[model samples]
Target chain A: MTILLHQNLERAAQALPEQTAFVCGRDRLTWRQLDEQSTAFAVALQHAGVTPGDHVAICADLSLPAVIAIYGCLKAGAVYVPVDHSSSDQRLCALIEECDATVLVITALSLNTRHTLETHAPSLRLVVSGENQPEQRSRLEVVCFSGFLAASGRDPFVRPATTPRQPAYVIFTSGSTGRPKGIVHTHQSAGQYAELTATAYRLSSADMVAGVCPLHFDMSTFALFASVHAAARTVLIPAPVLRFPASFALQLEQHRVSVLYCVPYLLIQLLERGVLDQRLLDSLRWIVFAGETFPLRSLQDLRSRLCHVAFSNAYGPAETNVCCVRHFVPWQECAEPDRSEIPIGRPWGDGLCRVVDADDVVVEPGEAGELLVSSGTVMSHYLGHSADDQPTFCFCPATGRRFYRTGDVVRQNADGELVFVGRQDRQVKVRGHRVELDAVENAMTRFPGVLEASVSCVPADGSQQLHAVYTSVDRQALDAPLQRWLQSELPRWAVPSVIQRVPTFARTTSGKIDHRRQGQQMAAELTTHNKKES
Target chain B: MIDQSSFSRTEATRQILQFLHEELLNGSGPVTLQADTDLLASGTVDSLGVMRLVAFLEAAFAVTIAHEDVTMENFLNASAIAALICERQEGAL
Candidate 1:
């Protein structure tokens, strides 16, 4: 009754034997070819000392090689961890060490990355898959992805039957403090998440998903594997697209991609570029976006542009696969609902989300509380941190099942929709005033000329200052009205200490605000100011 | 609102100053900055300040100033940064 994620992928291959499973430019691989490559890569890795339960980290962008390697790692019975090739040299090294990665498969540009990584973690066996290597670098088995399989030319290998409880992948997410946390997930959790997503979005073997999120980011879990599990094809978008949005969408239109998973910020840029053209969206059947929600005007434009396709908002942290979804809510309601707030919506099949108070008591309808999720899709644990209770997986008496505390503040509306307030830690006391930014943003979201807003805290003049980052296309016109609106609605002390404008806010691969990056940016800015003043 | 004519006197420094402000300097200040702003020797920018400023010029102007370009003559003041930006522009063309 229970199936591992790889086994399900194998099943997808069996169902769509000759169908194209993945396509990258002129390079097309049928399901059969994909299965053969996966098996061969699995064997190649085994020969390289990768055993069951080992962590094999693929340090590369989203491409066919990375995708197959993920499959090979799972098929070989090891938990696969992915690092964005674009991750800084420092971060890449930190992740490899943090995950205690065994073997790394990388390309040439990441050669510097691989070198720096090995210098730190010398035990990590490196597999350089690229052009010929120097004589001295023999230990770095330099082989092309195809060459690796070609060398094993139809070599017979058996995939060990992995149980549902076995770990499938280890994904790293930002920590409030030092290094990122590596959250591990088992086959049951990963595959269950894939199934829930496929059912919610109505993805099938006929769908051609435009995979956008980086592999290191958790959003790509559903974008990549969900498509593969459904026997659907994934269009391997190039990595540089993150730096260029217009080009990314052109690739979408060129490929006639049917299913798209994106973040709201990128969607905002796409709208700014007037990318809501009907021609580009004609074949698109669904748009599933995650991270933080964007303005409603965007959803309305997107829906009208692709009037026929479904627009769904996906919600959940990396620690948990997408456990809840609110689909087909109109852009207007979703952007500015009747309650002037939107819920991550009802839990999808087999997923349970409830609002609970401080004492774990379930709140009544329209009451605000902590959101807890109980689902088969919850992560295994933060790898190597088995002793932490905050990360502890437990069963809730209210849900009568194991649930993960989402740490998000929300209130169930009269319509039974859950509207997000913010994170519990996000609440702050500013100058004897308790300011919940979510409340301010929720209020400002109703103000005209207010496209998107995020409130962050800082210490100013011996008191905490609430800073708001706002993004408006017509910044020139928005300046005066926005300042006036904030002055009227917010108390003297509650007003923003600094009102900063970004041409565009940094976004996580999930399209939510890249708060971690913003913090780094804010810190750097503060340091710059302190020096300037001194 | 930058007095473009006022910048003609310290073209090199002004360019570098703007580059630093957009890329290196993070906090808010005069939107229209000037050159000969006593950037480095005057203690306007420090070591990490230099690195941050270099990264900014590279991304904002799409220029690549070499490690050798990180010199007193190129990064000392607005004139220096403008010179650096100019050198990169010439090389790029």
Candidate 2:
């Protein structure tokens, strides 16, 4: 009796066939329609030679078709890999090759992306989702969405038999080696996460959930799968709409979204832009925040404004599906400004969470150490890489349970709650996207004239920004070319916010790059620049 | 009530092209940017580029472009962005 993820969709369609499932702009779909369309899509994938355990790649903006593609791949028992629509051709090709993807579903809105796929990944089949198909030239066959759907019969297609232990999907994350690492999660892990999330949020079919995250981001699981598990309707907010806080707040009101999962950076932006108001967000009950640490001052402001909404801070890596969660009573937390740190709180379910010192021994209460978490929701392994290559896991002989080293420094408070301190590694969250400072520096060093590059995250206006300090003796005019090179090589988010030219980098007593002092100096310079502008 | 003299398409295009050359692409690059260059289609302007362009427009034109106005249709090129700026300035008038 294995619990499958697609079974959630089947059960919801059986119970509430006419209920609204997903809403993106004016487009809406009922459970019955979603179930049927996904089944038809699965049949179409099968017709296109997508067999069980095949890898299907989806690169599109947040839309109905993208949702359908995700479920269809799952229903067909294939691992779905979602990349951002804005990914460069090189990165996308690398991902396709990395996963050995057989079929790629794209939107006509992205003609450049479609062309790139056709040009680069010739062996892979392309399923165009929108109109305005260009004249085909590649050896691969291209099928328009309407044509592809029409090619398959309307009969309900049964999903292939799969156990919970099988791999469900692979999500790519930033690697320290300047290459993206694919983390594979089993069906049981993802299903348990969705179920646990639904129960934690107390979601019901009556709740309207707001999807504020991109499909490639791990936090989006709550918006998509968790909503399905609870039979709740999810309303996806487009990226452009996210820029306009007023319109986004209006959408929340119009859609009557009761549950929301978002990063603290976005919450701060909405508050700063004056888009968050009591009346506009009156329907919101649960507001979950993750991906990055929320500044205590901003959290206080948000809590004070929206006293009725429950604020929960969740802590986990992409490897672990949200192991710990802390629910905050807005009124209670806002009253005490002395609460400088927000506790990530206790573990969800029976998951084990421990704070260990450098010696791997359990730390004393209130002593900082690396946080280790292990549960049924931990990722299976990194794809194409052996456990020894990048060992984020350890098998403890005493406990007889494998544990993931989260690399996050934390301590248990007096109340037996985990309080996040900082990261022991260079991994930092830039606008909720995981970025490795070393990885950015690695890309920076590849430039023709770069002698040495030191990249670090600096605190700016309550958010983290990557700032680079480089010394290039050969390249006199290095600013613009270096920027262009970085833009072409790395994703936009991974690019540095500000790059400074220096004759030489400061070194510590051990002759290592002094990133700490560099970060401090960069922050000070940015502050002075801000003052001068004012 | 409206002074329409400041909103010139040619002037907007000149400024936008200059900014793109200086900021996004190096001043001297293989890709020749034009007024009608498709920013979204060519992948010249991505999400971060859009944000930087919005900041530039707000500072240069002394106008505010709302988030909804930052779509691909509006920021696809110098011409579209210039048109959006003109429209916003006219609305302000």
Candidate 3:
């Protein structure tokens, strides 16, 4: 019972050596091929001086090489930190520095990124995984994918000494105080969640899983690890295709994908577009949605359309990959009447869920309170956090177990299922990515001439849209320059839809930024502006 | 080809640029949306941003972009996006 994540890949390769392991676009790799290539890549990483406990940054899209790089980094006993390949070079460089990455595994698609990193983090070793090789650059050691594989030779398997307690990965998420918080997870903890996911989804070797989420997202763990654990074939849908439901549905049909893991926003987009039809999704058996709350109407519409497919709504913070899962039973089967909202379900695996009051006392069942999760899957700590900022986990003297405050509002129903209320903090999900409204505002204030700023997620055309309102001394500075600056500082999704300039931001009685009242004022302003144009 | 003249590259670029400036770029930056502005490579619009842009184009141009049409090569920049719209409009007409 080895808990190392790569051991599953090794066993799967040994058992089903010729089985199709991964399909990225037109490229397909067998279990043995993936194992051999990753082993070779791991050997190359060691030869290139990546030691155990070293951080390897993987900044690439959903490609075959990206998958191999993840496994290779794990096999090499290094932490695999995935950053979005589409991020600005500045953002990518920030993450690379924040994670203290010594090696970066990137693809040919991001050649510009390689150059940027070379200029910024000059000491980094770059391994290019694509068709064409990049030209030699000064102060940087570059290795071509084909050449590295060839040079490493066959069966040069070098498995560095690793322990279950060692950090396996570091995923950066939005922080309330402005900076991106890196959540570190140990090998055992991450592997525990992966195994739990595979069993919970009832995945098997015959299942073809469609990974719609990006590697940078926490949900992509199923795409990378659970499939390998189950010896199931994982298919990564391209970023562009994911936008078009008709195209995504066609891919599902063509591949006979059995399990789908994506955010509810995507599902809602597909349903809203009216392109998610039966023929396109005839092969799908399980529809797993997470990262945000699922709208009731969208869920009902999907269940009505795909009656045979099972719908499972998952809930958890990036701290604990996925702690709670609620399977939607049919309306007729439930004892209680159907409600407008969906319950986040009971805790999965060894997770313990509790709703606590302000005094840290557990609330009575059916009462709304802040949810806390106690599990082995909780993140080790926030990267680079001081002793005061660390310890999101609290030890329960009564139970002698650690509990991480989820900061999510939830309540248990009569059936003992935890129903999601709203977020207790200013954090909101923009297309499944966690965003701290204050962080966006912080970035906004940093722009020259900006006096004060606030951001809110407003409902627009049946979708959550980010709207920003700011007061600036220089009215001219409220436009394009501010946006370009925010775009550089934040991810693309964090960029506000409409950035408006105001004389002053409304405040609360306590003189704090009255987010709720400001949101209403901004909504009214937008309506008035719309009316004037019409 | 009958409606190709109906969708001029300059007009298409102007409208798309306006949409990017307002909806995507928030009209606060020094972003110059030229014909060759490399939207995909420069991260001007991400994958999610592209989806919103597609919806905007489909509505503004009255041209239905197929699922296959949402590629980085086809929607890479103002010129490529306008070219896609004109080609689709011509075919539709």
DockQ winner: 3
Error of 1 at A479 (Å): 3.1
Write down the C-alpha DockQ for each prediction. 0.04, 0.20, 0.22
Per-residue C-alpha lDDT of model 1 across residues B1-93, encoded as one tens digit per residue = 233334333554555665567656664544655565655424346434555676666765667765545555455567657766766766676
Checking candidate 2 for backbone clashes, the offending pairs are none
Model 2 C-alpha lDDT per residue in residues A345-373, reported as the tens digit of each score = 99997699888988789888898888988
Give candidate 2's error at residue A516 in angstroms: 13
What is candidate 2's TM-score for chain B alone?
0.86
Error of 1 at A7 (Å): 2.3
Question: Judged by TM-score relative to the true structure, which candidate is superior, 2 or 3?
Answer: 2
What is candidate 1's CA lDDT for residue A388? Answer: 34
Q: Candidate 1, TM-score vs. the true structure?
A: 0.80
**Superposed Cα deviation of residue A398, candidate 1 (Å):** 7.3
Report the C-alpha lDDT of model 3 over A1-534, residue by residue, as the tens digit.
438898889999999999999998799999999998888888888878889988998877788888888888898899999887666788778888888798887765356766788788754766555656657655766776778767777655756779888888999873324888898988888888889999998999999999878778888888888888899999998666664465667788889999988886567556644355545666788889887655555567667777778889888998899999988653334433446457789999889998998788999988878898988777877787632242476768888877888888788998899987656787788889977776677677667566567788887757777999876542454677888889998899999998888644554211235677788877777778778988
Docking class of 2: incorrect
DockQ, model 3, C-alpha based? 0.22
Off by over 4 Å in 2: A109-123, A126-129, A135-137, A155-158, A277-279, A332-337, A385-390, A427-534, B1-51, B63-93
- TM per candidate comes to 0.80, 0.77, 0.76
Which portions of model 3 miss their true places by more than 4 Å?
A109-116, A127-134, A330-337, A385-391, A427-534, B1-93
Give all candidates' CA lDDT scores. 0.70, 0.78, 0.78
